[model samples]
Target: MLWPTNYTKLASATMFTLFFAGATFAPKRMVNGENIQHFLQRHYCNAYKYLASRLRHLDAVIGFEVMNEPHNGFIGLKDLKAYHPTETLGPR
Candidate 1:
């Protein structure tokens, strides 16, 4: 299963887009006073449930890096907010 460089990059980008595109349309509500940990736990639980059902055949995907260069700014916030408004840190 050796994919060519361009193919690998394209595949990765496509997968990222599909995964995040779903996230973009997810229900959103202001967690008025929720702590970050609590918010993340609740959000992750929902996400895991959905992924478990939708991607059940896939065994597991354990670790994750938030973004390539995640920082508070136009590009960073724009990218993160596009897929995860609830998860984005406020403007820098």
Candidate 2:
């Protein structure tokens, strides 16, 4: 019977390199704040509208994520107004 010798060493080395690299270079964490959801929603909506207009085929893309962390507590009509008194809260 014939056996391949290089495969095991190659796999082991690749795995070790990836593990160490990930440990050494972790991704930056995001900070959460009360008005962060509203801020993100406002900016993303503008961007999405622009993109949809330019790429007419994507007009159906009407939804967006507020943030990776959903601020359910900060996502109410009164809370939104309190955060940005100048801005009016639209339909929920």
Candidate 3:
């Protein structure tokens, strides 16, 4: 996939990248006294809770899963500002 043109536009740009940056990219600390990963997780939990509260009474709605296909966004990279991956492959 083509890399995004703007890397720092986290809120409205690529969501998967944002998920990685917010959820799992480490050196886990606080920005302005807020742990962003936990903040993101709390939002997910709250959404699930809201859905469960509304749907638990129904017989067919049997389950819920959060963080579907969670990705390690930029977790192991040695450099943050440079595009490192040199290749991409399509269906063979």
Provide the overall lDDT of each model, using Cα atoms, as 2-decimal numbers: 0.42, 0.37, 0.51
Per-residue lDDT tens digits for candidate 1, residues 1-92, read 33222222333434333334423432342255654335545676788677667766666755445345323222223453354433333334
Score every model by TM-score.
0.27, 0.25, 0.54
Question: How well does candidate 3 score on lDDT at residue 20?
Answer: 46
lDDT of 2 by residue, 5-78 (tens): 22223343233223323222322312253233344445667887786677676767665563332222222335
Error of 3 at 63 (Å): 0.6
Query: In model 3, what is the error at residue 48, expressed in angstroms?
Result: 0.6
Ranking by lDDT: 3, 1, 2
Candidate 3 local lDDT, 3-74, one digit each (tens): 442332333223444444654543365556666666656677899999899998899887977654343445
Candidates 1 and 2: which is better by lDDT? 1
lDDT of 1 at 71: 30
TM-score of 3: 0.54
Deviation of model 3 at 1, angstroms = 7.1
| Ranking of predictions according to TM-score | 3, 1, 2
The C-alpha stretches of model 3 lying farther than 4 A from their native spots are 1-33, 81-92
Error of 2 at 18 (Å): 30
Clashing pairs in 2: none
